[model samples]
Target: MTDRRGVVAKRAEDLMPGVPYVRGWNRARQSASALADQLVLLGLDSDFPGLVADVNVVGDGLVQLGTVRPEAAELLATLIAAGLRAELHGTTAETPATARREAPAA
Candidate 1:
């Protein structure tokens, strides 16, 4: 028998089956706060949050998006290809924040 706790840690993608992946970041030397501000300025804040349900600032440069609709997911992909530096996972089973918080402490 194997100790469940001893199992290898799963990447976010592994744990979130069917969950969409989304990532975005500021290209310039700007903080995540600034990036969020830019999203607001671009009029994306209003819909993006509701669409994704969770938007997390990773470190000082990157932002992660939680679950989102197909159209929103497509938009995120298009943004990435268009130089927004975004990443998409697939879809989300739960809020990414909840997943992170539920992770065992290292």
Candidate 2:
């Protein structure tokens, strides 16, 4: 479908997050909102729902993840593979949000 700008638009789900994965990401990068949706696909939702509560799209290739457990850090490699970079914020006993070391993705 073409937008008002006359640019052919692709479905959000059809766009992959990583560059090497598909050409969809290229078109996705042109729109901030669309790219953000693509990034969500790379999130640790299935196996680690509690691990991440929220995903905030910061930019074309950046996202801030709200994590409940330290294990959420294990997603770094997957995130990288998805052509995205992430910052993890975990809830701590001392505070609601704190930076913790990332653990390996098991």
What candidate 2 gets wrong by more than 4 Å, as runs, is 1-36, 43-64, 81-106
CA lDDT of every candidate: 0.40, 0.35
Model 1 TM-score (2 dp): 0.32
* lDDT score, candidate 2, position 89: 36
Q: Which 10 consecutive residues of model 1 have the lowest summed lDDT?
A: 52-61
lDDT of 2: 0.35
Error of 2 at 25 (Å): 24
Which tens-of-lDDT digit does each residue in 1-106 have in candidate 1? 1138844222332324343334322332244456457556544455456322222222122233445656555544444443432225443343334433443442
Highest TM-score against the true fold, candidate: 1
